[model samples]
Target: MTISLKYRIALVVFVLQVAIFSPLLWFTFTAYRDADLQQLQTREDVFMRLVSQLGRKALLTAEPTDFQLFIAPFSKDSHINRIILLNQSGIVVASTAPVDLGGPLPVQKNERNTVWKTSEIANATEQLGAITVHFSRAELDKKVEALVKRGIPIAVAGIILSALVGLGLGSLLTRRLKALEQATRRMGAGDMEVTVAISGNDEVAHLAQVFNEMSGSLRSQFDELQQVQQELSFQAQHDPLTGLPNRLLFDLRCSQAIATARQHKQLLALLFFDLDHFKNINDSYGHQVGDAVLRCVAARLTMALKDHNLIARLGGDEFCVLIEQLEQEQEAAAVAESVLHMLTVPLECEQHEFFLSASIGICLYPRDGDDEVRLLRNADTAMYRAKAAGRGGYRFYSHEQTSSVQERTSLEQRLRKAIERGELRLNYQPQVCLTTGNLVGVEALARWSSPEFGLVAPEKFIPIAEESGQILAMGEWILDDACRQMQKWRRDGSTIPRVAVNLSALQIQRSDIATLVRRTLDSTGLPANCLELEITEGYILQDADRAVAVLQQLRDLGVSIAIDDFGTGFSSLSYLHRLPIDRLKIDKSFVQEIGSTSRAAQVAQAVVSLGKTLGLSIIGEGVEQLHHANALREWGCHEGQGFLYAPALAPDQLHLLAPFKRLP
Candidate 1:
């Protein structure tokens, strides 16, 4: 029902035409009628004048022929209906009406009231002196009728043309508005394919242009939002550093695998892998090095497993692998072994080489409770059991192993309590010079005088210490105990031998190691020269720069540095030349076969030559026989530590060492 602008304009124009022309048309018709009437009256007057002239000529000359001449001219005027002449007595002399012309103007009707004289005329000749004229009014009435008939058709044609123009314009404008409405609806429903087709320099066309631009902008924004959403989803399910599936993704895969295994009556195995002493690597190196190590581990695990198998990082040093559609448990074990072997090889990072290892635990579906949570927990328990069986190995989930895991877990809890109970003590093993038979140094060894466990082995507890980050505390206690022993030796008028304390990978890589060492030496009032820090060669080779810096700081404090288990590493003389080392302790593996095999003798001789060239002393450890000692001395090794001389002893056992003769 809405009206378009063109229709409304046309309607207004029509209304104005009617308002103005109705009265004008009425006036024109009246004027036209009056003008025709006036023309008729003028024609009648001329004819009457001609009649009067003829009658007057006849009266003046007494000639009827003159009258005939003028009357003939008047009769030729076609617009006149009749003409008549009347005397002063009101008698018609000549008449266009036949009856009125021949006799006295019989009673004059209102239409024929134009007479020559009225009642004022008296004498017969004066009053009856006649002038007659005649004319017809029918011609004037026909002319006015002709004008009205011609005007009516033209008016009708004009109205029809105006309507057609209005309709055409209205249709064009309304269609554009309709198209705009449709496009708006489509855009509202999230479709940008619709476009309003309006081409002109008018307002509606401009509106259409704006609408198209709006749709384009909205579509672009929607696309960008979708991309951002996808990126967020990727980050949520994947580890940012390793680009591997994270725990959330792992859980989802685990659930799906479990469901499929149940349906097929097959088994799914979940392998939980924990990096052995991974934190010690971080503590010995830096977190940057730790991240690199993790990336390397992830790469190795990925390569070991098949494409269908799933591997995911469960955060930190923990990762999980799911083996689906496996034929047997051995298949999963084979994969775990491959991972273990590949990871055990040295990982080279920024010129530092590291021998990384993993402890793997396997749990099977249906047997380990076919659920994600149960599988994950069982796998974790089996992994700890693997670590307990000595790390860099794998263990399968069994109900029997549960008791052992619980016992180990309980032992860890008690070990924490032991520190508070002050049950831990230190023992010292003498480092004897092979040639001089003098006690050159002592290696401080930690022992747990546990009230419950009685005595615990270092191998059993040190892994626990490394895992729980309690090694830092245990290391601190060792330092304190060693410094105290040095102070006691000095107070008793005995010359103080250099006390070598082993530093865990974590302890030596600490940035504040220098401060901690200085404080420990100060607190015990032990001379810095009497303290020697023994670090494993594996940790030092991981980051030579960091290791050298820490060693230099210790050296600057008047303390000595030695690389323990030196021969077993990828020992490059280039790195050794850069290290501020005072001694190189040959690993027990080489020392055990010394003087027994040519290969062992050659390794021992090479180490002695390398140590002498680097201006570092060589100490051979685990020399259990006299020939072992004699061989090391002949090889020019400076010191030897073995059971042949003395085992690591308690503080109270020092008197027994005093009575025994020193080794030659």
Candidate 2:
């Protein structure tokens, strides 16, 4: 369908030749011949002049003999076709036509000149008579014909020779061009092996050479593209990091396995494997070490699986194993145990060693659901149970387990719609001074009363909400609600302490957390000092510098920041001194066990002393026992909050509690 370069070049060349030669040939045939005709006419004028002089002499001398002698010399010239002299009476006095011409000169219809009278000539010729001459055009035609007959053949032969030479050169030019054409066809067909042979040093040859280089470059690019496409395909069906079958491949295999099992009436098991505290490892060390750990884990997983048992990575420290033709669920459970056991050993990469564990969940065919999504969800739920039960374990999927997962999933859905339904409310837990027993602050706790499921616990739905990104909206609602409550109380003449709102990791992960908090404070008309933002120490330590910067910005705005659940995170207390923190709330885990001769009590005292040494106010949480509150006060804790005092109450219920003056 594509035209070749050779044809195009030849077309251009022939057009140029015709354009130049056609005009030149036209000039030669018309303009040059016309100019020759004009010169012949001028000669006829000379003959006419001689004839006129002879006739005038003859007419005036009254001697025919003298006239003939005068005209004889002019008539001897061969070019004079005809000469006629007319007298005053329009009679022919002399004729050079070899006969007496007519009294009036013979004139052709398209005559060049016509004489009227002596009066018309204005008497310019005194003794001269009018003379007319006609040249022999037939003889001129014969001469012109002879010249053309002789010259045109030679001119045409020269043109033919030049055309042949031009065509030969054009053919030579097209030879390399043809090779380029073939090369282009091959390149289009995805065959880049073809190469053009360029010859000579003409511009066409140079063009061919450039085209060849371009073809080579394109071939290299195509090869790289092929490699990239293959890599993409591989990554599509497999995990790029672990080089193992990914979730897509896992789902495909699971669906097919379920179908085959249903057809053959065979038992199959789907096992979900989760690496325990994998994110913590990744955070403590860098992702590189974590990747090395994952690679080791993948190798262990593959080794533990049978050839028929398929294993795939389900992304982010989670993997799945499909056991085919299993006789019993225990068979799959045994394999899960093997994998968990294999993961226990310390994995070494370079000089670093990582110790990791896996929590495995098993779901069997015919007993569990017979579909991909159902079985995977069931197994994943059981795996979470195993992890919650303390990892280095395996759990078999049961109907109860499936129900729990469905409930959790359903809870997550409801939580998503919770804020929109206006089912969420904030309950204020009073944080009072242990000595004076006066309210110092209130912790904001989110309570959801769903129409579908009434009074869901925070522990049940908070994590699900957090994972679904709904926590951000829910957290914003809590902030506004709590701040509004404080404003309402201040307007109602009830002494209001700081309103402490728990902030989730997801909430603070937003870089705009400070802005959102400031805007909420401004909108609620609540002073920054009256609002407190509480974040767990573990969340703040994830990205210390960034978290510290955000906290410092909030602190500068007169907003109080308390490290909730202190001494529970793995961070060293020394970093706490440098943090722009206002208070440390001892974790309830320690406060609950205080005075029980338990290590939890010692941990609580350590955190209190650490807070005091750093000039930070220490608030003891979960202080249900009077002894716990007395111990915290003796340990220099500045505040206390727990069931030993009043628990969280609704905004209306806060009016009944004893109030304290706001801190200046």
Candidate 3:
């Protein structure tokens, strides 16, 4: 089915040779035959003319013997078979053969070997008998046979020579083609180095040259593609900014490490840590600086850990370390301490020095968890515990922490449903004018009374709600409920001036809090001036510019803004004057320490004086004793609130008590 190039070329050449030589050989044979036949024709004509001239006299004399003598000699010639002289009456007078003497001339018809010719013998218009001559074809046949015998060998030799030349040419031409075909096959089998040898300027040689160039191009492209694939694979597994293993690679290697640890019964530890207050750095500086810091942290961590231990960036400022073949469980703590110590040194990036600290959590194999997921989760929980206990420290996994996490998770689930089931309510604590004991405003406090856990404290569930991202919904509900309650109190003829509702940092950061407040006010038909929003000082300082913008929007809508727990956070006077604020609440710690410590008293007095200087109203919180209230009033505080006046009361109770004035 598949013919080789050499054989195909040979066949084509053989066919062409046959086509050309066959016609040439045939023409040569034909021309030789024609020339021989023409010579024979000339000889026959001369012999007939000679017979007619010699026999004329004899025929006129009517001498048969003389004619016979003359013809007999002519017949003896090889070309002549017989000669005769006839009388005018058509009678045979003489013949070389005696059988034809004195008989009419014999007629020859359909003869193979001989032919006859006749001529009239006349002298001076006197009619005489005809003379006849018989010519044999045997000599012509012998000459033609000899010619054919000679030409046969010559034609065969010429044909054979032509065939040999064709075969040789075919082989010579196909040799390069065959080599190219083999090279093509090798290239097809993935040998990009394969190339054909070029020998001539013909099409096949050009084709080989083109194939070689194509093979080189393909080899180069393949190498580039392989390199690109490797780079893509590395990028997929590595963090682009820090050049650390990403979460995907970390998970894979962690799984593998867990399996090995389980199989070999070896101790393994997973350390989870994240930079403390890293968002503040990203907020204060640009993300470029933050990225440089992360890279620096990654490098330090890599150097701090053992080579066998795997350290990976688990996204953001969080990282995980896998320590295997630990001799003791305390080794994990030692590693954690080493990592913390390594981070104690300041890092400089973009010409700024940063003091970095981290909270680390350690979970051991077969002790804290048996698998990667559990180990990571427990380590994260312990890391949070470290952060809560004040950062730059590490904590090991404990059953109490697991119990707490489960309890918090359960609380979070219940809290989500509690908001929908309307189990949450608001209590109003009256804020009295310290100068006149007149009711100025009341702070609306959220209270949750779950059927499963009665009267759950705000401190416990508030943080849980914030962490689980349910604070947005819960904050919205509190704002709406507080506004509606204030409206109802106004309708019931209560003299409460305004109602303050607390806002969490998550609410402001994660949601459009200004819009939410405006919508709530419009829906409740509550006067904006009659509503106040309380945000913690720490939340405001976290992103001061954005916070100022959001507060400015609220102020434009005639809503009051107050800084809650003012002195407890990193307060900056630079942004404080820029804030759209109406009041600053003295932190309860300072209020509680009023009569106990002169330092606390001085701090509170300074806050009040600062508020006065800023032309902002100041309120003292947790004023539990007469001395505390007297101290706040003497210090020129505008308002005061504590159990001294009243505990947070229900709406109806507050309505009932609104008319009464408290005297300190």
lDDT of 1: 0.78
TM-score against native, each model? 0.69, 0.59, 0.68
TM-score, ranked from best to worst: 1, 3, 2
Count clashing residue pairs per candidate: 19, 0, 0
**Tens-digit per-residue lDDT, 61-180, candidate 1:** 545444545455545666544455555455555554556654775554445323332222124455436553333455666877787886666556556655665566666667788788
lDDT of 2: 0.77
Off by over 4 Å in 1: 1-175, 274-306, 337-357, 384-393, 400-417, 432-441, 451-454, 589-620, 623-647, 662-664
Candidate scoring better on TM-score of 1 and 2: 1
Q: Candidate 2: where are CA atoms >4 Å away?
A: 1-233, 251-268, 274-309, 323-359, 369-374, 384-394, 659-664
Please give the distance, in angstroms, between residue 516's alpha carbon in candidate 1 and its true position after superposition: 2.6
Candidate closest to the true structure, highest lDDT? 3
The positional error of residue 401 in candidate 2, measured at the CA in angstroms, is: 1.8
Point to the candidate with the largest TM-score: 1
lDDT of 2 at 19: 67
- Runs in model 3 deviating more than 4 A are 1-182, 240-243, 259-266, 273-309, 315-318, 325-359, 384-393, 434-438, 510-512, 594-602, 625-627, 655-664
